[model samples]
Target: MSIATPQNPALAAALILAATTFIAATTLMAKALGTDVLGTPLHPMQISHGRFLFAFMGISTGVLILRPQFIRPHWGYHIGRTSFGWAGVTLMFASVAYIPLADATAITFLNPVFGMLLAIPLLGERVGPWRWGAALIAMIGAMILLRPTPASFQPAALLALTAAAVMGMELIFIKKLAGREAPLQVLWFNNLLGLAIATCAVLPVWQMPTPAQWGALAALGLLMACAQACFINGMARADASFVAPFSYATLVFAALYDFLGFGAVPDAISVLGAVIILAGAAILAWREGRQRPHDRAPAPAAK
Candidate 1:
């Protein structure tokens, strides 16, 4: 039992870190494919559309093989949940192109803070003192990261913040929907929604990608799917908080990829901000681990 705590948490965090790092690296590759190979011709929307198109097909194919009947879900929750995911995907992809990966990822750490705030009203989940303190510290760290001045800030940072906010909303809806459907069903709706929204946003301006660009898009889709799968499996095996902070490892991977692959390195200020982001995530993880003792399945009643 004791072994499960550290062992499972470490395994889950490692899996999540790998998944997120791959996804972050793929984003860097997408930028190269778009700019260098595609001559900066592929719009963000177009890339999103292509990526989601492949993802939807991939998920649909798997569903057909593994669970044929899932082709049609309960339309109401499916549509609702899909909408949240749609917005999250669109916003997140847009941010990826506009912001530095480290900054973008740091802003994303705000999601759980927002989630904690929303839970008080939406889910009736308590915010407790320790979690609230952690959230405050996280927000201060976010301000340092954002800088929020013309000389210091890029407008793209705001986009990443908005992406985080939207992600918070998506997560809330996901939590609500989880009890009603299998996780795979939720994942299917997410991809379908991503495709639908990306199509609606990008179709008017869509230009077909060249073979190389298409290959990059395919790679991007595969990495995105892999990240989602590993994240889900990891969380199922351990606590979300325990697994969440390592998601920040994507920042390290992103920075390294950008430097080696694109010659872009984050500044010292950005590095400090990244540290704060990791600190906040660590605080959240510790809080959850401590709470675990108080959480357990109810004992079976005597006959």
Candidate 2:
């Protein structure tokens, strides 16, 4: 068993904040790429394809410079993880194009709720009353945000929820992969397999991007890579539960982007639901943090 020593809290918080900002920016840029900000809107698949394609290019270049061994025997696990990740990205980008960025991003926070449910079956974990109550509250919050009246039903909101669920599964796969693989190996496979899957999916619907759109696509990939790196750094330096809450800042940044970039704002109900979801998620995070043994295994190294 390995013991964890806390790193500098201020730096961890700053890294997480920066990561969320980058991610929020990437989401807004992706929405613009698939919307009318460009002369012609790209397909969501095409946008996702560019995200992974360029990210792979950048990371692979770094890998060559760093000269890390990339071989791994866990092809099956990599395939499963990247496939879910690609699906989540497609759904998320599609939701972003159609909904307010804040609402879409808030819905994605349901990932922890979904992850808890998945752990029951996949990890053979038992759910106690506290967690079950938290899950119920989160579900209520999701329903509030969804507001699924016949006339008010939004398919985009459902898409965001689906993306969150897929992401939850991706997290589970990541846990499995982390047990046996290096962080860099997992990162490499994620980009490599994600690129291959996205390219094949986008080929039939692909439209050549204009110069401006191309720049946006490149920025999208760069921001995503930077965000991942920042998040990894933050997670490495602090207890995950301590830094994870800062991830909710993505909603704030997304809201700002939505208002300034698109003149869109979330309604009152959406705001209330977002608060409820955050509250429930906070409870879960707190419980997880408290349960973490001081003498437990050390956190894995950042990629």
Candidate 3:
């Protein structure tokens, strides 16, 4: 059964909000644990590898009992997406180490911008006037957030950008695959593929995590898995376009955590950039909601 209804906007919004919160927190938790708890240099590979191993195992167990037939489909998309996901994961985690969570999260939001660019070329998706305008505004915001100077160029930020580009491609592939394969199968494949790749890459650099770090890593893994599952379930309960904007809630959550946990406040310029990104995301979501004409109105929440 296709899992989207235009009538249920509120449900979709809540779903997106919850999912975004979890995802936003993952970066803050990963960076704090990797740097402070692990007592090791923050390497994206280690975090990604560790998180995926635990998440994959956790989800796979459920599949084993509920539906074992997912194994075949899992291998194909999982391996393919893991190739892209690894790059995205590596850059995202690295950015957390190199920059504040809000900054990294803001830059990562550039994924939608990349997706728009890719859609025009690969998917033949039209870049309508409003979307083009939104994209331009988002670019301006990106420049402000980056604030490049001759003396200080952040290669880490660039890696994040590259990762977003790859992630955009992965999104396109996943959307196509979603129609043909079960959601669990798709997720399983991606995780397993990432696990194999990460295991190989992290083996050389892997330092045994201290007990505290182990706990943090475990928490990170659980949060990541739960966040993703919540997102999928919530998206199923409502329309994608309605829920997509709620993804921006991550920015607010990230900013809050940065201040409270790390005492890191975003500069005015970064905040401005974040606002611009949110505006652009809002435009995108509006476009999608309109495109899905039959979307159910969000079910009213209890007073």
Candidate 4:
């Protein structure tokens, strides 16, 4: 078994930040697609279809250019992971349409917490007090930031909450595949299978996009592909629990994108909640760095 140690934290941080930026941009695009901004709002299924389709094209191009040797994938893990991923993304897209983007994004903060907890069983990663404390504190911060009045928890808000749960589960499969194959190969198979799955789901709801929507879809797909690539590479460099908190950075980018694109400003509660989450993450990350048990460079090439 690979010892649990910190990998290249700096490089991992950089990659994860890039992923959050791309992911936040995709969220913005998804919000636009679900609204009348691009003529008619596309269905969440249709939007996800576009994400997989374009991402596949982009990854396939890379596969051709690099011509890297491929490895046999753990198909079971891939299938489970992709299934959860598609569901989570579709739900996330749907939530953005029914609720404020800030609120939708805030709820997703729980995903990493869910991921950390699930990692205990799924990834067989040991969670110390620091990890548990960090996760709990982040969860509390998320709830506080959400400011759940009786009316605050709208029925539609459940969509984002559910998306978080599904995505938390998605992280397990990602961790499982993190270093088992080439990152590019993993992405290629993921997008290829994702495209097939999305196609089947979108058939009933598919409609030709206006030229503008088509452009938006292309941009969204490319951005999401970049996010996935960064995320996978980042995972290769670090353990999942250690990387979980860094994902909160996405909230920052998400908030910025929502405000810039749609003028959804965050209130003091949102700011306060996010600060607490970051604080917990910071504490955990510091502890992880200090321990440094799993510190080894990646193999020159994945076999």
lDDT (10s digit) by residue, model 4, range 1-303? 222335797888788888888888888999999999888899999999999999899888888999998878889878987888889889989988876676677777666567767766666667777777877787777676556798554666678878877888876776666657777878888888888899999999999899999999999999988898888788678754466566767778888899898888877876787777677656665555555454211111100
lDDT of 3 by residue, 81-117 (tens): 5677677877788777777788778777767667667
- Residue 280 error for model 4, in Å? 3.7
- Tens-place lDDT per residue, model 1, 3-112, is 12233766776778777777776677556654654555577777777777877777777778888444445666566656655565556566666567777777777777
How do the predictions measure up, each by TM-score?
Answer: 0.85, 0.90, 0.87, 0.85
> Model 3 off-target regions past 4 Å?
1-8, 68-76, 151-153, 292-303
C-alpha lDDT score of every prediction, in listed order = 0.67, 0.79, 0.69, 0.76
Q: Please count the clashing residue pairs in each candidate, in the order shown.
A: 0, 0, 11, 3
Question: Scored by Cα lDDT, where does model 3 land?
Answer: 0.69
How far in Å is the alpha carbon of 291 misplaced in model 4?
A: 6.3
Provide the lDDT at 39 for model 4: 83
Summing lDDT over every window of 10 consecutive residues in candidate 4, give the lowest-scoring window.
294-303
State which candidate, 2 or 4, has the greater TM-score. 2
- lDDT, candidate 3, residue 150? 70
Which residue ranges in model 4 land beyond 4 Å of their true spot?
1-10, 123-126, 237-246, 284-303
Residue 247 in candidate 4, Cα distance off native in Å? 3.6
For model 2, the stretches where C-alpha displacement exceeds 4 angstroms are 1-8, 69-73, 292-303
lDDT measured at residue 66 in model 2 versus the true structure, 0 to 100: 85
Which pairs, if any, clash in model 1? none
In angstroms, what RMSD does candidate 2 have relative to the true structure? 3.4
